[model samples]
Target chain A: MNQTSQPKLWLAQQANRFAPALFFIGLVLLWELICRVGKVPNYILPSPSAIITAFFNVEFSRWMIHLWATLRVALMGFVLSIMIAIPLSIGMMRSQLMNRILYPALIVIQSTPVVAVAPLIIVLLGTDDPSRVLITCLITFFPLVVSTTTGMLETPPEMIELSQSLRAPRYRETWQIRIPYAIPHIFSGLRVSITLAIIGAVVAEFVAAEEGLGYFIQFSTSFFKIPQAFAGLIFLSVISLLLFKSVQWIQAWFFPWSLPKKK
Target chain B: MDQAKNSAYVSMKGVGHQYAPQAPLVVKDIDLDIHRHEFVAVVGPSGCGKSTLLRMVSGLLIPSQGEVSVFNRPVTEPRDDVGIVFQKANLLPWLTVRKNVLFPLKHKYGSYSAADEKRANELLEMAGLTQFADKMPDELSGGMQQRVGIIRALLLNPDILLMDEPFSALDALTREQIGFDLLKIWREHPKTVLFITHSISEAVLLSDRILVMSKRPGTVLDLIEVDLPRPRSSKTINSPRFAELTDLIRGYIYEPDVPA
Candidate 1:
């Protein structure tokens, strides 16, 4: 018989949670040291500490403002995408004529580079929040529509039979059988869209906007505040991460039964 | 009420179907009459269009040639009076076991209330899944999931039950268990059942009559009456009479390859 296992082994395994942050800390320390030794000018290569100080001291309020602006636009675009996508997907599923007419146009919309089109949109719609939101919607809309339509159409034949035999109304079948079956795929598309939304907002801001993380980055570079520019980059990344995580959380919360439990 | 005592509840008149207009007909000249409270089993070899015929009767398919009438009304599309249990459990993975049972009721009633919840709980309890009500389909064993499917079908209190190979996926032990459960439900609620299967024992153990069908361009070859008493069990399987009937059905199914 082996001796009782030490509880410290379990504690050691739990310490894995901090590994990535620790690794990032170590890299930052090494980069700071290298920059100091190399006597790199702040304009050329600001140390990690300088970037952090700039982020905290000078840009905190502006960062919050810009982050909120981008998030608001992105959120509005995402909600609109969901509202429009679901019905369009359902319509496409109900009619092959609708699919034939709309699918090619959807392909064209998805394939068009959002970044290249942002300038054109800004010119057409003016440099307003709506234009930015439109660009965001453009970028994120197709995936949701395509995935949801595919999901609704691909409902298990047996489940369809089950619904049919119940004499379920067409609307009821669409709601209970078709939509619920499509949820997993719909969530997958939504996860992809969350990040695309952020990218879309940023690209639109890059083309035309007086406020937002994209504008902050643009202005910080003009003023030669390289560390503050990097700070803006950090803000954008954090926004992207939070958006992605929020979608994951939403998917998990609403569809607890559908999700595969993690080991 | 007395008229319902004798005539067929479901009558199929010259039903024929094909996958496409140009394709060879899969089910040709099928005429079946299932009386009220009767258990009819359609048995055939694979690809023999037995399942296709059931679909037509259930109104999942429209026959190219003939009419299907349930309770003397044309079955133009699916009706709520009929419940279907598919070969697989086919429960949506996203809904809990109880929710799956409540699915048909939701379509029937169109809203949720405390009453619906109570009924759902009752159905789950009846299915012996009281503890697993919140469990998703993927979390349950295959036999357990199939039980949930059965309960879901019964929740509607349909006038007829259509089953397409409902137990063919289960192991022998599980199949026997479900077969008995089905019989108990049938006894408790006398619905006209049209069950499709390939197993001779399954058809024998459950059906009032077994309709044996021949292969492609499928047609009913024979109708064998199962005069076995009610509440038949595994003990009944050991009886000489049960064995004789089972053997007779088996011989028909595996009849010496008709010199095709």
Candidate 2:
């Protein structure tokens, strides 16, 4: 009896996993039908089919160029933010003087609007990729710092005592115990910042850049190529989704223990 | 007297500690000597600084007033001679059981040799955790985790092992089982052990001598020696002497307001 039920249970679980995708497809079909039956103007509200056609009509090479430009800025900004934020957070956690001097300043900076500051940064650094990357980095930096520091502080008191009893050196304790314990929190920060990195890059492009998906959206809308503008928006969402999924995959790979075990 | 004085593995001289300079002393005027290759248990009421006394012996905390020494050396900092286990198993969640056992050894000695690996495997075998050695801490039961904690403390071959309520978290059956395993292990490889627990029965079962403490501003009330035969088992607790010693310790813990 158990053997017969096992495969049946497996089949149900697989279907349960795919139920969300099936509902998404049904929603898209309903949207397409509504657009066709209403005879809506393509410029006002393009159907999903029209958007797909617009996406394909653009030469793949040209589409990739814009996508690559946006991706490069976002990726560079994200990496740079991690590089700066982790060390700064670690320093702040380790020394009271550093924390007192920089922590409040960081909170004040974080509270200010990134869009308001982007133009000022562009004026200071030119309308080049450097300014765009800097804007993205600014937007992504705070969450990483906050999450990393919180994780470091949350290292269990018993673990600290254990390390002390072992007479572990300061650097070794930080590297081996505190940092690994903080990894799940750090990844949570990464998940939040990756999405913001994309938004930051786009906002930067809107303010100053001559290239990227953000520039494509601005140029398309100006010419009333509404379907093309929708296509660029779609590409942005696709890129964000892919990056989010990649972070989740890397988290699962590096910290398998954090994942829930299968029965 | 000279031989006993010379063999004192851990000596505490009027040790006292408080969190702040003006705060009431947590445990005061603690003078004790744990002899070499002896199992010593400390039992007391809750918040009686039983853990504080254990911490002082491990050199995790410097006493506010007096000194703690191990093997004739004054302990100003944590040393390689001491191993400590906290109330929780406190195993690193990221490491497998075998790796967690070898963690301190790797940190203290820089790296592990073939001999270290063999010793780790032998410990796992001895604990009957051989099959689960590669598993993570979360995969094991509470009893198993504490067993691993014990093994991790043992790996460095420290002269003194200090345990703070190590078995209090386990269910009664598992606690008894692990307590038996601990006694057997101690019989085979005897080291000076200072165990702290709230359970008077556990103190009676494990230690050569039980130090019962009074309520807060904790100080040793009585040091009762257990005259039970070596290699004690579950049947030993049913013996008349075990009951008398436990009752005697319990009286010190509960009847602190009344004069002796």
Candidate 3:
């Protein structure tokens, strides 16, 4: 009975491994059918095949340029957000008064719709990459601060006791115990912030931009370049997925101690 | 008076601790003096502030009144010479057993060198964890992780070790194994130890004297000396004397009116 059961279990495991790829192929086939049968207007909804064809046929350099623009904004905003959040989190953890004072302000900032702030920031800061970066930074910064502070503050009492009994210096305790303890949470916040940063950059570009995926989308839609617009949308999604996945990968690689970093 | 006449390695005089001003005391009017190299266990029924007393000794908590002194000096803050282990091994999951043992030393002294590696390995060997040195905390069993934690404490070569119900989390068999390992380490290193546990058998097996406490606001009820010989084993638990001491301590723990 055990011998037969082992082979059955192996088959079940193999089935699990093949499920996702099969589902994705099935999805593509269904999409192709909907485009063929429904005869949806190309201007409103481009066919999957046409979008894929345009994606590869388009001048590679032109796409690279757009990719560079979005990547630059995303990376810049992510780095800026991290710089602002880490120190703020440390401050909040160090003093309860700081948490009491600044945490509410942070909630207010986070709750404010990024779209509402986008035009205002464009108006105040002027139409440039700085405004886009600043908007991305604003969208991404608060959550990281909140999560990092929560993580640092949530260090287990036993770990803290261990450090205290060791007579560890204040800074060493923070760096070795608190910071490392907070890495999983911080990475989770950063993952969300990274995707948000990309969205923020695009939205900021929607208000005022001569380049970037948002501008490309706008230009394609106005010109009735429907396939190209869908292709641009596809590119934007890939950028987001890549950014999110890369952070997830980093989390897995470095902070394997935690439950797979929160998506 | 004869006990007091012995050299006091660690002393707590009338120590009282309260969580809040309006709240009741957690531990109160506790006076204790441990001789040099003494293995003392503080035992009481649950919530009797046995753990709180060890916390005071470990410098993790400040008493609301009175003093805690180690080696004749008042403990103002956590002393580098004091080592503590909690019921939870509470090891950093990110670190291997070796790294966690080296964790305290790295902060005390800057940088990890060949000397640190040697010390970590030596500690691991002492804890019977040399084979598991490279394993992460999560990878180890509960008993193994606690062993790593004990090694972490010994890595610093502290003058005294404070353990609060450190074996309480493990199963009976593992707990018994660790009890023997603890005595072996204590015999080799010869540090003043203040071990806290709610278990009567554990106290009987491990301590030179067991300080039993009343319920909160907890105060020391009695300090019973275990005249049992050195390096006691799990088998010695069957001995008539061991049974007698166990009953003596167990009597203090149970409420007479409660259903047995």
Interface RMSD, candidates in the order listed: 1.7, 1.2, 1.4
Question: Residue-wise lDDT of candidate 1 within A66-105, one digit each (tens)?
Answer: 8888888899889889888999999889888998999999
Residue-wise lDDT of candidate 2 within B14-55, one digit each (tens)? 988897998999998888888987899998888999998888
- Stretches off by above 4 angstroms in model 3 are A1-15, A259-263, B1-5, B255-260
Candidate 1, true inter-chain contacts retained: 0.82
Q: What do the candidate models score in CA lDDT, each in turn? A: 0.86, 0.90, 0.87
lDDT by residue (tens digit), candidate 2, A116-189: 99999999999999999999999999999999999989999888898889887877778778888888899999
Model 1, span B1-260: residue lDDT tens: 66776797899889888899899999888888888989999988889998898888888888898989988998898776777888888888878888888877777568667787887788788778999998878888888999898888787677888899998889889989989988988888788999999888889889999998888889888888998887888887887878898787777678576310
Quality class of the docking in candidate 1, CAPRI style: medium
Q: Of models 2 and 3, which has the larger lDDT?
A: 2
How far in Å is the alpha carbon of A135 misplaced in model 1? 1.4
Q: For model 1, what is the alpha-carbon lDDT of residue B129? A: 91
- Decreasing TM-score order of the candidates: 2, 3, 1
* Model 3 interface DockQ: 0.71
Interface DockQ of each model: 0.64, 0.73, 0.71
- The count of backbone overlaps in candidate 2 is 0
Error of 2 at B213 (Å): 1.6
Name the runs in model 1 displaced over 4 angstroms.
A1-8, A15-45, B1-6, B71-73, B112-122, B131-139, B255-260
Best by lDDT: 2
List clash counts for every candidate, in order.
0, 0, 0
Which candidate leads the pack in DockQ? 2
